[model samples]
Target: AQSVTQLDSHVSVSEGTPVLLRCNYSSSYSPSLFWYVQHPNKGLQLLLKYTSAATLVKGINGFEAEFKKSETSFHLTKPSAHMSDAAEYFCVVNPGTYKYIFGTGTRLKVLA
Candidate 1:
């Protein structure tokens, strides 16, 4: 199985606050990393990805991550957490397989 790690299983924040979702991974070959956001009863939305290109990858919804091979970490960060951001976040790795291996999954709660 591919290697992936989520530093937190849950994150709580107030609206308009900053958000960070930490992840670290290991792979035998080059890894394709993805950050997906899931709202309640909603499918996963691609937030960002790292494809062995640039170390720093920019993503939709003003999110970004830096791929660090030394530390093997790909952390998700947002300047401000919107109420809509209160959902589940998953850190996934593609190990050249059809099925995606997801992290434990993080639940984000936005406080008013």
Candidate 2:
């Protein structure tokens, strides 16, 4: 079985500051990791993904995550934060079973 854990339930950042969202996972095999974002009342958007090709993967909107196999972690980071970046984020793990395990969620709040 595969599962994802998002360390934080909410993250608050000031506009223009760096952003970090932590995530951890447990899987039976090499897993596929993805980060998705959802704005209020909006559909989820794929931010980035790791499919066993690269340890470090970059995604849309200056977001990136590193696949740390040793730690079983894939933490998301962004160089700077923006007001528009406020949204709910999810960490997903696929263990090649065609079933995805989703993290609880982390809501990003960008403050002025």
Candidate 3:
């Protein structure tokens, strides 16, 4: 079984500052991990994904994540925060199946 846990329920960052959203996973084997962001009343948007490729995965809107098998972590990061970046983020794990295990989610608040 694979599962994902978002370390933070909420995160606040000032505009133009760096942003970090931590995520950890539990899996028996190499698992596919993903980061998705959902704005208010909007659907989930793919930020980045790791699927046995490069350890450093880049995604849209200046976001990226590093897949660390040793630590069982795939934390998302951005050089700077933007107001538009404020949203609910989800970490997902795929255990080589159609089903996906999602984290509780982290709500980002970008302060102006």
Candidate 4:
């Protein structure tokens, strides 16, 4: 079985500041990890993904995450925050099947 957890349910940051959204996963085998962002009433957009390729994966809008097998973590980070960046983020783990395990979700609030 595979599961994902988002450490924080909500994250607040000032515009132009750094952003960090933590995520952890438990999997029986090497798993495919992904980050997705969703604006209000909008569909999810793929941020980045790690598929046993690189430990560090970069995604759109200056977001990136590092896969740490030892720690069972894949925390997402951004150099700077933007107002448009405020959204709900999800960490997902694919167990190599049609089903995907998703984190509860993290809502990011960007303040000016």
TM-score of 1: 0.92
* Candidate 2 lDDT, 49-92, residue by residue in tens: 99989799999999999999999999999999999999999999
What is the C-alpha lDDT profile of model 4 across 13-109, one tens digit per residue? Answer: 9999999999999999889999999999999999999999989999998999999999999999999999999999999999788878999999999
lDDT of each: 0.89, 0.96, 0.95, 0.95
Residue 66, model 2, lDDT: 98
Residue lDDT tens for model 3, 1-112: 6788999999999999999999999998779999999999999989999999899999999999999999999999999999999999999999788889999999999999
Model 4, which residues run further than 4 Å from truth? Answer: none
**Candidate 2 Cα misplacement greater than 4 A, ranges:** none
Q: Estimate the Cα RMSD of every predicted model relative to the unseen true structure.
A: 1.3, 0.6, 0.6, 0.7
Q: How many Å off is the CA of 81 in candidate 1?
A: 1.0
List residue ranges in candidate 1 displaced over 4 A.
none
TM-score of candidate 2 relative to the true fold: 0.98
Model 1, 14-112: lDDT tens per residue?
989889899988887778999999998989999998888998999998889999889989999889988877889999999777867789999999999
Name the best candidate (by lDDT).
2
